[model samples]
Structures are given as C-alpha cells and as structure tokens.
Target: MTLTEKQERALCVLDDLIDEGIDVTNLRQEIHLSNTYSYDAVRTRLRRAFGSVENALRAYGLYDQTAEPERLELERCFYIDQDYRVSENRYKSEELKELYGISEIKFQQYKKVLLENLEREALDIYVRDTFPYGLKRDYIYKHKLWHVEKYLRNFYGHSVRKLCEEWDFSYELFNDSYSSFYITQGHIFEGLVGEVLDAIYPGRVESQRRIENCIPDFIVNGRHWIDAKLSEKTAFNRASKTFSKYLKHTENLTIIYAQKSDGVYSFPNVTLVHISRYIPELIKIHRSDLIEKINAFLSNLKINIENVS
Candidate 1:
C-alpha cells in the first residue's frame, strides 16, 4: 500500500498548512495571507494556496463533499496557474476578438478546453513518473527503441564499461551492427514491460540479468515468465525455439511481441501480445479506476489530521 507520489506531495502541503494554523475542513474560507504583499498579490496568493488545498482535498475525497459555492470558487482559482494561461499570440489573435464577442459561450468553451488539456497533461505526467518505461517516438505515438542505450545508461547509472566492472565481468563486447541494435531493442522492450507490470502490480516484476542462464526477460510474481520479442521475425527464427524450450517446464508463460507492425499473430499454446496493444489496454484500465485508485493512495498516506474542524 505505497502512497502514490501525488499523495505524498499533497500530504506534505497539508502538513505545512496545518502547521500554519490553517483549518483543513474549512480550507477555502479559513486560509489567511500575510499583509506583506500588495492587495492584488495578496489576493492571488490566497487563491493559489486555496487551489492547492482544494487539490489535496479532492485527492483525499474530502473536497467531494464541499459546498457548491466554495467548490465553484475553488475551481475558478485552480485555473489561475501558469499552465492554464493562454499564449500571448493566442491572446492577440483576431480569433480571440471574435471569441470575446460571444463572451458567455466562449468563456464556458475556453474553460472546458483548458481544464481538459490540464487534466490530460497532469495524467500523462503521473503515468510517466509512476511507470517510466522509456520509449522514443516520432510525431506519432509509436514505440521506437532508439533511446534504448540511453535509458539503460540512465536507469543503471553506469556506462557499458562501468556495468561490466559492477557485475565483476572480465570482458566487454561492442558492435554497432544490427545484431547489437537488436539486443538493445530487446532490453528496452523488456524494460518497458517490467515498468508497466510494476506500476500495475508493484514489487512483482523482476528483470532477468545478463548472467542468468535460460531465464526469460522478466518473472512476474516469481511464477509467470514474460518474454519480450522486439522483432517480428524472431517468431520464425531458430533462436525463438531455444527460448520456447527454456520456458517449456514453466506452467505459465507470456510472450510480448513489441514490434511496430500492425497485424496480429497467434502462437501455439503460448500467450502472445503486442506492445502497442498492451500499453493502451493497461492505460485504459488505469484510467477507468483512477479516482478509486487515488483515494486508496490517499488512505495509504496515513495523514493524521487532529483538527479538521
């Protein structure tokens, strides 16, 4: 029951607020700013503070019971952050003047669009932080393993030479050929799978090391062996037969085909999956239960509030 990063951050903010004598239950009405700032800046500061508290409350399910007037005011204040600000060019555009002509309708439309974008951006950030399975892509969202070596370097905090030393290896191998690229691609795909699995089912994914003989890419829950195939042609390759033999004794095994191709293929008596399909499915499931998950996350934080009233 690990607290999500958002919950941890929100808890810290709540602790600060409570330490400052701000009432958590009546956050919007009770928060008070110092007289040091100008009137406008003070108002802005108060709004920003209230917005943060409102976010924390919402994360904890406390804000769901907020009064209508307070909730609406908090929502308005929440949008004042720099991320919600329109670009200067957009502000000066002729379309802006036309939009302003129909102020009431345009305001509602603009708010909707802005809030939707903000929510999407926040979700994306959270997903990345929660499951940093690295995949490079072009303008379109396609899994490209171009950043494989880079990710490995960063994740392991070592270069190839350093890795060899850390692992107590005597020799090192290097080649810029397709074979080397293929190996790196395989590692990247397996890493992505491991990250996603770990996010959904934390502390269950364990990557197979280079020295591990006859091991699959990952072992989930110490039972299911997950093999990542980055190349479509690998299915037909003789090496795949050897891989199959390694996992033959295992009761449950899954093959993750992580190539960029579109079509699907089935394997004999084996679970076959494509990365493109796999990632989106996991994202959909996560999004479907996101609110309940966040609430669970808050409960895990164990924030002791002595003075909510």
Candidate 2:
C-alpha cells in the first residue's frame, strides 16, 4: 500500500531516526513540526504515519552513536517517545463509574492503552496474523520475541506505583499532561511474569500484594517469591543485585530475571531464565531433570534467601 505524502515523510523521518538511533521524539520535535508538536498532534501524526508505531520504531536500524550515550537516548526515545504514547485507554468508557473516581479511572485507562501499545510493538515480530493481546504463551521460550517472554493482564502503573509506595521506593508519578514521559510497559512485564510463575507452579503462586517489605512480583505457593525484571543485561545485573541485597534479610525468596538474553536464561540458583530458550528447551528436557532442575533452582534460591535472612 502506498503511504500519503505526510506518512511518507513520517516514514522517512522514522527510518532516519531508526538508522541514526536518534530519539524519534526528539527527531519528531526537531523535524516534524519545529518544536510545535503537542501531545495530541504528535499522537495524530504518529497514528497516521505508521501501521504499527511501535514496530516501525523497533525497526530502528543502526544506532551508531556512543554506545552508552546512544542507549540512554534510545531509552528516552524507545521508551519515552511521544509517538508510541498515542493510544487511548479503552476503560475511558463510563462503565467504571462506581468502581473508581473519574480521575482514578482515567489513570487506569491511560495505563491500559500505554501497555497495550507497548505490547503491540513488542509482539509485532512473533506472528503475522495471530498476535494475541494479553494471551499467555503456553510454552516457555519465544525465539521470535524481542524483549518479553509472555503477555499478561490485570496490571497497570497504579499497581506498580502502589507497590513503590509500599516499598518507600520514592518513585514519582508524572502528571500525564506535564511530564516529559518515560514509556515502559512495566506493569505488563510484572503481570506476565506473575502469570508465568503461576503457570509454572500452578496454584502455588498468586499476584503479589503491595507491602513495603513484601516482594513486588509474585507469591508462589504463598511462600516462594519473585521480582520480575524485563530482559536486559542491565536489568539482570540490577535485579541480581536486588536479589543479593534481599538475601541479607528474607527467606524463600527467588529473583526471576525473565529475558530474551541467551534465549531464556535460567541461572540454576540465580534463576535467570532466558525466555528465548526457556520453553522450547524445557520441552526437550528430560522430565526428571526438569523437575530436578526446578527443585535445585528452588533449593539454591533458598540458600540465597537464607543468606538474605
């Protein structure tokens, strides 16, 4: 299909940004409207320009900028781009009247759209026609995915923010209309990890409850615990450190770093499960070893927890 002139321009700029690894938002700011793009206009132009705004950005080709510097910029662009933030929440419908205040419902609605858009972007690569929204991948590893392991539901920023509050995390919520924006489907990542853990242990795990000192990801069999980290090396290191710190005080704790890293990396005791290799590889595993490995994982994790406690 041919693109409109404006969309062609948008595509040109998009390809340039993707190739340059330049911030699409920054590029959009500098090239599209000369610092005049409002959130709504930007949203409109982005939707008009690309079939999948997130996918186009993921096609961002070569980021030749300074490695670390460019990465930070990518984070700002990929996660913070105003273009990807364009979707509206479905919960905006009036049915939420008695369930929450207008303000609260609006927050959840926005959260839903943001997560949906992000997932749409990430899931765009897996299948041509059957990208399931919030659908759990029954098997573990996904060789096709770029960043996530599975899709999850029933989570949003409000939940994470609530947990942050419980942990005294001091993370601040940005006013939608005012803040520059940091776009991460963090809630979805948390939710999916919680869901997968539940599947793995079946009835042994439940979504985590927010409590200052409580684990923020999952409660397995009402005892085992997980702190989910989106699959990135830095995220792994950070989560590993957090787990290390956690070991100084808690018992029966396990930090699960779900990543596309090395195809679903599961560090035996550390529990770093590579989502890429996880399910496929596990499917081929000898049932005995798989169970034994899972048991060993819990055991070593318990050892880590003992140290933390």
Candidate 3:
C-alpha cells in the first residue's frame, strides 16, 4: 500500500525522533507537536495506514536502542541487592524503609531505582522465556500485554521497539503481523458467528458463499447474508460500502458486530446487531454448550461476552 504525502512526512518525523533517542510510548502527542496535525488526527491516520505508530517507525527503518552497559548495570544492580527482591517478600514501602533505616524520602528514591532495575530484569527474563529468539510486537498487543508494556515504559523507559532492537530482531519481518493479527481475530469471530448460526438454522447456514464480487461470511436459508465484524460500527463504513454490493444479490443482510455500540448502525438492506446480545440468546436455547466455547474465546481475547439469559 502506498502512503499519502502526510503519512510519509509523519514517518520521516518519527525517524528523526527515534534517532534522537526520544521515547515513543507517547508517539501520537510527539508527532502531533512536531507537525501541524492534531493528536487524534495523527493517531487515526497512522493507525489506519500503518496499523500502529511503532509500525510506522519500523516502516522508516527506525527502532529504539539501549546501550549494552545500561542493561548490564541494571542486571548487576538487581543481582547484587538481595533486598530488591520485593516480589518474593511482599514487603510494604514503610516496612522496607524501616528495614533499611532510611527516611521516607530517601526510601522512595531508593525504591524507585531498585524497582527500575528489577522490572528490567524481570522483563528480560520474561522475554527470554516467552520469545526465546526475538519478541514479536504484534504478539504482545494481541495477547493484551498492556501492563507489561506500561511497566517497561514507566519503569525501564523502554518500548517494545527497544526490546526488538536489543534482541537483534528485524521489524520488517514481523511488522506486517500487526495488521494480520486483526484479520486473524476477525476471522475467528466470524467463525464463532458461523457456529452460532449453524446451531440456530442448522444445515441452512452457508459459509462464505460468493455472489458476484461480494463474499459475505454466511448465507442463511439461501437468502439472508450474514457478515461478522470484530470492531465497532463507526469503523465499519468502508466495509459497509463494500457490503452494499451484496444487496444486488440479496435484500437481507445482517451485520453482526463483536463490539457493542451506543447507537444503531443503518444501511440499505442491512440489519445491525451486536454479537454479545444476539448470539447468547440464540445459543442459550439452541446450543448451551456453545456458551463455554464462546466464553473461552472471549477469555483468550481478554474480552467479556455476556452470559446467556
């Protein structure tokens, strides 16, 4: 895909910032401040075009770097100070202060430095165990590692891009996985919808039956088209336009959304329904065992699907 001129400019700015050793966790604000684009605009454009700001930086051959000595220092400090093993002891800050015979202010400063190194050490161990050869940025986000990302940024002042660089990983090889993750997730949700539909309309549900240029997710009773979306309706306008082509084949089109929206989405010959609401109701009566499967799927996605009533 070719990037627009503005997107190209944003990538250039991001390239310069990474070279200057800027922390990119707050990349949207950084890019917005560096250019005429608003924060939301920059964020939306980058995400729409590059999947993420990190991926945009990767597109420009930019990745974060940390000095080898700094990592070694963190590891040394963590190992040398046995008391820094706060996770095992579960000591309160006050208890630690008293044990060390220090004022609260001094204890706070001491704890800050200790935890910084400790977090880095823990993160390193986690990366080594979980990703052996290299950490995949898309895997982190897909698995909902927000806490890990936040901890690394807040305590270690490092981003996933930095870890990738440190591990000698190539972003070019895995950056595309960011977009593919969403596509995979969407396909999973679509399959879940198809299963639910199969239980409801048994033997009447057809999968990905093509009609002209459009291939809807499912066709029920050889008439209605069912399309499962794993995102909010506000983000479905592009898909909706494409689905409009299916109207020529079938007047009935059901758009099932995995995520709930506050307002109803409207389109010609299309009926919008949330998966959480519609699927559970059908599954409760048609196939209760599917509840376990649905919940397991949601748990893996780190999301909640309402129980069947």
Candidate 4:
C-alpha cells in the first residue's frame, strides 16, 4: 500500500474495482492504462485519490457484492447522465433568454446573496436546532425508491451496513399472503396504478421501505405485492389478520379496500380489491389476464403440425 502512498493505494484498489463491476469508463482505464504505470503516473495517483476522500468511495457505491443473506441488497445508482437541458445558461437560464428579468431590487439582491452564503457557511449555525423531519422535498422521493428496489424487490434489503445514511442493518427473510385496499384515494391511487406499475415492472415496485416484518405497502409486476390499509372498521379487522405473515415471501398479493359502502371488489386467488374497484374497467382485467396467459402459451405450442407429413 505504498508506491509513495499512491493516494492511499489507489483508494484501496478503487474500492475493490467498485465492488468488481468496474465501469467508471472502465475505472479510468483500470487506474490509467492497465498497469505498466504512468498514464501520467496513474493520473497523478487518481488525482490524489479523488483529492483525499472527496470522492468518498466514488461517492459511496460498493454495497454488498452478493452475500445475499435474508435478501438485504444494495447497488445504488442514480444516472440521468446527459442533460445540460440546453437553454440560455449563465444563470436564471440566461435571465429567461436574455430578456433581463428578476427585478424587485433584483429579487431582493438575490435573496440577500443567498442569505449571505448561508451566513458564511455555518449554515445558520448548523440549522440552529434542526427541526427537519419528513418532506424536505420527501428526501428526494425516498432516495429514489431506495436506489430502485421498485417492484418491492422481494421486500427489505441493504442487508447490512449499520450506518450508510443512518440506518441499514436490515434483514427479513420471508413473509407473504396478501389482499388489501385501504385507501381513501390518495394521488388517485398513485395516478391510476402509478404509471402502470412503473410501466409494467421496471425493477419492481418499492414505495420505500419499513418493516416490522412485511407489508411495505405498494409493489407489483415483479410478482405483485401490496399492503395498503387506511384503517377503521376495527382497523380493517386488525390489518387483515396482520398480513398473515405475507405468506412467506410472494403469493402475488394485493389488499386495497376503500369501502365506505359500495362498488369495487375484485378477488382473484385472494380477495378484496377496491380503490373503488381499481377502475378503468377494473384495470383492464389485469391486461386481459396477461393476454390469456399469452394465448394459452401459443395454444400449447402444437409445433406447427408440419411433421404430420
């Protein structure tokens, strides 16, 4: 670990080649042109190993390279990558395309120079006594549905890291048995099944995590999961027998009950479906029962009968 301490030995082999998936443009070509040293001395030792920890393990990536105990997973990525959003830049998107805007004493002298640069960076003395909780713009959409464990990614992962962003020592191996619909209609049931279950399962539903063991409310497609209950009627009969231990992982569950008397009841292999009976012709009867199981697996694949000759 010491070619004159080559920036903490290339940040511990660039965090074990970014947990062995490698690809920060092949990790700057395997730390500068695969080893005979001197791609300008491995880019001056990876620019002083991302300038002495400002890269923080390439901004925190290497999460559990598949130890896979009790499904605690993590591989965070947030790439929108290309968007200068081509506009009249040079701030205020070029003062709204060079019409020279923002009067009212130049918007109170640019909000008094951004509160005097957050009171000379003490950030108002570390936000005075910090009263922040929930909805600070919803912690960027629950950390983008917890690094995309969307279709409920078999519920609860990031298996161990006692402290990444505060709490992550999570593990819940099995639980499944589902039926639920207890909404008073919020965001019109996520604007008609949340953009058609993230356009039919792009990495499976995760409305974020929380587990006293299962029912992390909202999942679909990557083998359908859901647990939403708005309460009352003796707390929806003790939360429908407490998600009957989510039938040990997956029974393609749902339990959406918003019945203030009338309409919406769909029960297939389980029962009680009503966010007003999950409308739009009961959500096209689940894409016409998955096009009748892909037309009964192409009518039992008769192998086109050509061999009958």
Top-scoring candidate (TM-score): 3
- Tell me the whole-model lDDT of each prediction, alpha carbons only: 0.45, 0.41, 0.57, 0.36
lDDT of 4 at 47: 69
**Residue pairs clashing, model 1:** none
State the weakest 10-residue window (summed lDDT) of model 3. Answer: 77-86
Better of 2 and 3 by lDDT: 3
**How would the candidate models be sorted by lDDT, starting from the highest?**
3, 1, 2, 4
Model 4 weakest lDDT span, ten residues long:
173-182
Candidate 1 segments exceeding 4 Å error: 1-177, 209-213, 260-266, 284-309
Cα error, residue 184 of model 2, in Å, equals 4.3
Q: What is the clash count for each candidate, in the order shown?
A: 0, 20, 0, 29
C-alpha root-mean-square deviation, each candidate = 23.6, 21.0, 24.4, 22.1
Q: What's the TM-score of every candidate structure?
A: 0.32, 0.28, 0.39, 0.22
Q: What tens-digit string does per-residue lDDT give for candidate 1 at 108-183?
A: 4344555543443333222222222222123113543223333333544434455334333222223224334445
As for model 2, its CA RMSD to the true structure in angstroms is: 21.0
TM-score of 1: 0.32
Best by lDDT: 3
Candidate 2 C-alpha error for residue 75, in Å: 37
Candidate 4 residue 61 Cα shift, in angstroms, is 14
lDDT of 1: 0.45
The residue-by-residue lDDT of candidate 4 on 170-274, one tens digit each, is 111011111111111323333445444454565777763433234345766545676543212312332333444454466777765332323333333444454
lDDT of 2 by residue, 142-205 (tens): 4333233433222233243443343333243323321112123344445545545554566777
